[model samples]
Target: MGDYHVRFCESLGVKFPLATRLEAKQIEPGAAVAPKTYRFETLWMALNQTNHERYTETNALEQEKLLDKILVGNCLSFFKSLDIFVEA
Candidate 1:
């Protein structure tokens, strides 16, 4: 997943700050599972010139980690509707 994330980030011209591999193990059989540790790249979208940049996350789970949630929240609030939202 590291290589895949790297490639994905390169394509989007984004910065990858955190990278980790996720794995799982089963002690017995019949525990069918496809374990995956996905990689992520965070891109700070500059909302305006007044601030350095707003931490708008492309990942849903990552949104909870920002120091200033309100700072980035306002910047990415527009995307909230788009997250799992379908326009009919």
Candidate 2:
């Protein structure tokens, strides 16, 4: 998971944050919705590392916006896994 984050940050040309919301996702397996599992393949399934490598190697500044969108989507998935509720 850390390796994936490292690669992702590198690909995005961004420094990693000291605290990441991904920590919640990593520690809580019960958070996943569909399969109820938080496997690497499941979390990273949509990402094609090969394509990302080629894209980053090209140094496409224009794609940073797209990458930010992808990161936002990933964060949303993590947020969705949160069990936030209230009972009165």
Candidate 3:
């Protein structure tokens, strides 16, 4: 997961916060790696927060804006996952 984050951030030309910390570590041969899980938890949490905010928003325009942002974010995430799979 850390490697994925490092690679993804590097691909975007963004400096990952923990990049230095990750580089300082040396894994022994055959060391156990962290278990892989679905990578969209943050996106799901953001979507839920957006949904909550939209529900509470009094203006229809604001609600539409929130929905549009969520849709666009989801599309971007989907495309990013496709890119990762293609690379794999």
Candidate 4:
């Protein structure tokens, strides 16, 4: 997942802040499970000048609220409210 995110960010000339591998665990014997594989998580951003300024101007609490709205709330509406077009 992290590699995919990194490649995606690179393709768009964005910033990939970090990639951290998740801990791996063995499946129980005879357990119904899919094939095991490495896992990762990354935070990537593709900020335009206006978006960058909007983000940078916010305080920590404001930033967290914005992030929560985007990540947990309705991201489409959030973007629409800001008139921001995000591909994919």
Pairs that clash in candidate 4: none
Model 3 scores a TM of: 0.37
| Candidate 2 Cα misplacement greater than 4 A, ranges | 1-47, 50-59, 83-88
Alpha-carbon TM-score of each model against the true structure: 0.23, 0.32, 0.37, 0.34
| Cα-lDDT of candidate 3 | 0.57
Question: Scored by Cα lDDT, where does model 1 land?
Answer: 0.50
Candidate 3 local Cα displacement, residue 34, angstroms: 43
Question: Model 4, range 1-88, lDDT digits (tens) per residue?
Answer: 6688678769989874673456779853332358565333544343556756877899999876765555534546666677765555
Ten-residue stretch with the least lDDT total in model 3: 36-45
lDDT of each: 0.50, 0.57, 0.57, 0.61
Clashing pairs in 1: none
Ranking by TM-score: 3, 4, 2, 1
lDDT of 3 by residue, 1-88 (tens): 7678678768979773452432256643321368444443232324475578665765888866876787667756776665632222
User: Mind giving the per-residue lDDT tens digits that candidate 2 earns over 1-88?
Assistant: 7788779778979874544444434463333446443334223434477656655775567466656667657766766677543222
Instruction: Write one digit per residue (lDDT tens) for candidate 1, span 1-41.
Output: 66786787789898667635556796532212685454324
The predicted structure with the larger TM-score, 3 or 4, is: 3
User: In model 2, what is the error at residue 56, expressed in angstroms?
Assistant: 4.1
Model 4: lDDT to the true structure: 0.61
Q: Considering lDDT, which of the candidate structures 1 and 2 is the better prediction for this target?
A: 2
Off by over 4 Å in 4: 1-40, 46-49, 73-88
